[model samples]
Target: MRKALPVLLLSTALLAGCAVGPDYRAPALDLPEQWPEHVLLSAEARADWQQWWRQFEDPHLDALVARAVDDNLELRLQLARIQEARARLGLARAEQLPSVSAQAEAARERTPGAASPLGQSSTDNLFSLAGVLDYELDLWGRLAREREASEALLEQSLFAHDAVRLNVIADVVATYFDLRSAQRQLRITEATAASREETFRLEQLRFDVGESDELALRQAQSELESTLAQLPSQRERVRVLEGALGLLVGMTPAELMAELDYGDTDLEAIALPDGVPAVLPSELLARRPDIRSAEAGLIAANAGIGVAEASRLPRFNLGGLLGSAAGDAGDLFTSAAGTWGLSATVMGPLFDFGRSASRIETAEALAEQAEVQYRATVAQAFNEVRNALVTYEASGERVEAIRRQVTAFERTLELAEVRYREGFVGFIELLDAQRALLAAELALSEAMRDRLTATATLFKALGGGWQVEG
Candidate 1:
């Protein structure tokens, strides 16, 4: 019976391949076919959204994005998480295989002849060596289900890491634009301040010559000081935004400043795409990383249900030991000195009232939660895309309107300056015109920034940068 046990266990292992509990299937979603009608891109152009930043046609932006990809701390952290998940997957896979160990022992002992029933004293030495094997037969496929769940978790980690990469790219791009916008605004304020100082000097000279009154001179001086005060704040904003961009790219403030070449930085020179491509709402399920991560979680949870169900059934463990034992070392391995044994262990929950039932219930509940979360993620993804589309469209219109307004303000300032020089209008009219022009210029810069940021947001919503395989 002992000799035949190994063969019987092997045959049982071959027959016990079925896993208990439910198999995994993706939950159904009532997805939309198309996005909001106002969005501009044709379905055929969706592929072009990949590498959307390249459309900006700026070398400096390209360099910054590459640096962020290589060194951003958040991205590195996600990569480490991928490694952790991969190690866990390896551990789960190892459980499916047999475990083997080498065991050895040696001893010397003396026995009284009376104790040995020999009526004489005797001494003996014993030595033994054996190789032992232990392996769970996986009768209900518990180990297989565990391995399946682990693989799903690994996939989830990978998708999450990709999501982080996409976010990092978007953050770096948006922050770089913010830095440029601040620099542009600062320059406009500085130019306005210098122009106001010149006006104040001319007003002071005219008042001293009795051509202008104290009231007019003081108004000019007030406008000049107000414009000067704005300079310090604008400069400060530029500095702070630069620091923000530096952190996004994992660089220190000093390093960012040195690399920025602030003197040559030209915010107005960077151009944006005229139109962004649109994608079908249904396609978003495969495109968005967060959605994919959620789905992976669901798969793992579904596998967990099988694992829990399998745990309630009986487990079969097969083991064997082979060795030789004799009074002399030379006699070990001889036919008469050989020894071997095999074992089979069958364990089942005989009296656990509700523990297995509770575990199965818990697994089912978690699986349901994963399904609901997946649906919510998809819904939220669509909402963000819709909002981005609307904002992008409105931002473009605002930029165009501000440009026209700036043009009119420029002409008004020119005419007001002429009228003031001819003494046909008071200095108050000139100051008002100058103030309007400065405000319009600043508004135009802000509008442009918004338009660019809206475009990036739309790209992010559409999951522009990464591809998940079907």
Candidate 2:
């Protein structure tokens, strides 16, 4: 027995090294060296990108983002999923170690010996207490592969949680910008309405004094009413945006119904970033949570192939039981009642029609799918970054152009007002100028909002401060 023990141990050790299936490696990507735009790239800026919203220097915005990260429902859901993945990883790791359990029992049995020559009956009691141990030898590394897959899945969950967090923060910032824009537009509309009201009042006085015709008075009234008509819709838009922002910050229904406290922030007052990074390194894409999550999924799938392959081979298990059995409960621990056992089991698929082979093929196909998905995710990430950069640049240009237009239109309105008062131009001309100025002002406000939101999006596309651990 002693001679056989070493041979069995050596054989088990050798077989344990023969793990089946393919190993995993990260796929290579083709990436650009730098962004298309010409701007300064500062390492300090990159380091602080996680708090990019704070660049606006708005304390309200910073607080909103912090609250959303803490309480957003979607982010909380991702955290729950992470917990589940961690538990699954624990289960997988446990599979590699021995399982120990304790059992205790007491039973009574009665025997009838009526068929015996003596014709007697008897009653007996049996008691047992045992400790059982079961362990599976990883002859083909099946358990190890399963554990690897679980670990990868846990990593995927972690990255997914970060992805959700980044998205929530971006959403909060963009929605806040929208709300502020709407409020600004509402203010502008109110101011325009007041100006037209005064014009109508003066025209009414002129008509009553027989200095202006009814046509002129009616035109003035029409303009005033038209401007007033916009007030309700503009106010509604402001309210709707408030509700939306409230929800993004994880407000309850009651809180959404109430007025949101923005602490006197104006869209125009929000600061604009000077320029985006000129040279975004391709390797920085690795910091993107979605990309990392996709690669983790690929790794899990790759490990799954090994698990399937190992399933086609035999599984070896060793079991042992150390127990005490006694006819009397009081004597259960006596040496005379001691009992022990050892067992070795080999379980393999003798014939399963092609089930095991089919599993392997399925696993391989999934691995291929994961690889394709990983590549696709990486491609999409780069595309977003490129598009965000372009949009951000274009939005800035639009703001500049609109600002110029607003300035020119403001001057034109002033000149038309003077010309109309001096009786050198018709009221129609003045009315046209007023309308043009209002349109330009509103457009400028919208353009500003777009630019700010675009910056937030660019930050999001750049993965918003997520960094890989060493």
Candidate 3:
């Protein structure tokens, strides 16, 4: 009884022993309390890290985004990663659970006459079956900490997958808008070329009748040739853009152009709902995915510190066996043959080549690295939001300016053409006006496309439209 009392007391002490390393506590992030400068932001964008894609009003875009989120290769890979983390958690949990197994064997032995007198003429066979069990006691909470770390990693993977989804959706929208802009430019160039051809004919007639000089004919032809020369390259740009959009949507380039809708009538309207909300930067610590993932990694590293430290202390295990052994199969489990044993052991690393200390140092370094990564992630997020805000606002102003320029240039071209027809001006004057109008038209289409793209970028930066589910 005295011996048993010491063992009991020892067990209690072991269980109460401190976990060797530092406890995990998330470090406080030093972030902005409010926007530092005047930002062109809306009040409607909240800290809902998901659903950033819905800010684009196209139903078609929304549908494509939904499809990609469910099937994108990158997102699927992250999902698989989360599954891996879950498996690791399960293995860690099982560390403290007992393991059971069955064992069986059959054997025969023969002895030579010269070896021993008793075995000189004898041969025997033996068979037995046994049950076995074993378990480890996590007295220092090492296994428990490991399981907790794995669970955190699983959540991190999930959030990472969501980040990928948001990124893909944004790409598709941006590329689709690009394709439309190219299409608009292509059609504009074609129309301008046709107009120049008519002007060339008129100038040729005037030169024949002595109404215009050779220089006028040459300038008119130059404008027509230049406008016509742009057609093939513009067409090529459209094809390239079509292929890009196809890849973004996860389809073949040929297939994308074959069924692409590039007309403004076909393009869906995207309404800018709102801008970044007025929220504390610290609140965003819970919203951003990369930030969350880094935090989880830091937690995992902290847990490893405990795991490594605990290795220096003794670990206890429970071992047991239950079964019967017999020479004859039918005799198994008889009272005389039945047997069972239960035992426990505590083992520790008495000596090592500084492995435990090295592990603790490595874990501390990694946790520190994760902290830096979290800070960097937040900084990058802020940069994106700031850049998106500036671009979106600038695009709105540029579109308006481009439209006005197009209108003024168009009226100028019409007046120059009327003067040339009335014999009050030469072909060069009309050609210059037409060329200016064409550039303005092209510029306007580009500005509109930029506006649409900038809107999508801002929404993505604000984490505007996704609904992430755990």
Candidate 4:
């Protein structure tokens, strides 16, 4: 009967308990089957998910992105959050197990009166040792709910870290492309300035010889001055872009310049895939990172309701104490001195009036807010993907037009130089042709830069190559 009493108490404790909080189930929402607009997400457009940055085929770019992922400040913060959540999970799980404690105590006293109740003349000494353990049975699943919330938070932190990494890669690639474009434009500006100077000199000579009017000379001078003004501005752009890139890759501009040379690299046109995998709206629920985080939070909030509901029910804690009390230290382990006791306790909040009720309401409201936020995030993601596709396609079209314009300008410059050599056209005419050619060449450089940026933007809008590891 002694053995059965503990078991019977446990059975009665579980039987009397009931969970008060609402159970968590994902809220349903109406979502589209897939993106309505066409995006050029072909099978070929999908690079190796493990190393998406390598698709650009720039070794330096790959290295920069790799370094940023490992060293970025924002990513490090998310990692710390993951560690915190793991610790919290450990704390929640520990609540389900016994809490044990040990104790050693000693006391001495003297009584000096034999005639009075408090005046005994005897000396007494005592020494005692004991251990205790306490645990709460999770009959209502309150502990389980708390543990689930912590685990969900841990997953959310991991996804948030991945999102930070993708943004870092995008920033590095965008900055590198900007630097290249600025350098190319600077080269064009210098060529134009030289052509303008030569034209001004020729016009001055013609005016002195009385072969050209002052108005004609002035027109030539005006063109030269305008082109010259552009050189300083273009040079400033190069300096600014260099500085911006320095901050991104964690280097000074002088250091970066030492490693990079003015070499032209071609930006190939990106071809979009014919048919992208049809991801339905329901799939979007699980695919997007921010949405996943929101959903995790919603789950956590729902678990919070359980936590509040469990508060209304009586809380049960079971504990046991074991050890020995003896007159001498060496007798502490003897069966004669050994002692132990067990207890079961329960307490309930008779009335917080409505605090528990308010908590449950607050949790439900937060969960609703998370659901709405998730849907909004999904809609915005679709818009971003479609917008990037349109921009990329337009950039592709611009590259073709710029290519033809550059070709025509090149031919025009060649003919104008020949005419000046034959003494049929003034040196100013040749200079005009050269200046126009430089502008066209720079325009082509800009168009190619735009094409690469557009493709990178599109890749980013597609959630930056999610690994689905979760």
Local distance difference test scores for all models: 0.85, 0.88, 0.74, 0.73
Question: What's each prediction's clash count?
Answer: 1, 0, 8, 5
Question: Clashes in model 4: which pairs?
Answer: 33-280, 42-273, 111-120, 113-119, 113-120
Error of 4 at 315 (Å): 1.0
User: RMSD of model 4, in Å?
Assistant: 4.1
What does candidate 2's lDDT look like per residue over 272-317, in tens digits?
A: 8775444365755577899999999999999999999999999988
Please say which candidate is ahead in TM-score: 2 or 4. 2
Q: In candidate 1, what residue range of length 10 has the lowest lDDT sum?
A: 256-265
lDDT of 3 by residue, 174-234 (tens): 8777877777788888888887788789879988999888998889888889888898988
In angstroms, what RMSD does candidate 3 have relative to the true structure? 3.7
Tell me each candidate's TM-score. 0.92, 0.95, 0.86, 0.84
- Residue 130, model 3: Cα distance from true site in angstroms: 2.6
Residue 103 accuracy (lDDT) in model 2:
91
Give the poorly placed runs of model 3, Cα more than 4 Å off.
1-18, 36-52, 109-125, 252-280, 423-425, 466-470
Model 1 agreement with the true structure over 35-123: per-residue lDDT tens digits = 66775656555465568887787888888888888888998998999999999999999999999998887778899888987688999
Candidate 1 vs candidate 2: the lDDT winner is 2
What's the residue-level lDDT of 251 in candidate 3? 65
Which residue pairs in candidate 2 have backbone atoms (N, alpha carbon, C) closer than 3 angstroms, thus clashing? none
- Give per-residue lDDT, candidate 4, residue 272: 26
Give the C-alpha lDDT of model 3.
Answer: 0.74
Rank all candidate structures by their lDDT, best first, as comma-separated numbers: 2, 1, 3, 4
The candidate with the higher lDDT, 1 or 4, is 1
What would the per-residue lDDT of candidate 4 be over residues 136-251, giving only the tens digit for each residue? 87667688778777878777787777666777778877777777777777777777778677877987998899988897688778887887888788888877776666566555
Candidate 2 Cα misplacement greater than 4 A, ranges: 110-122, 277-279, 466-470
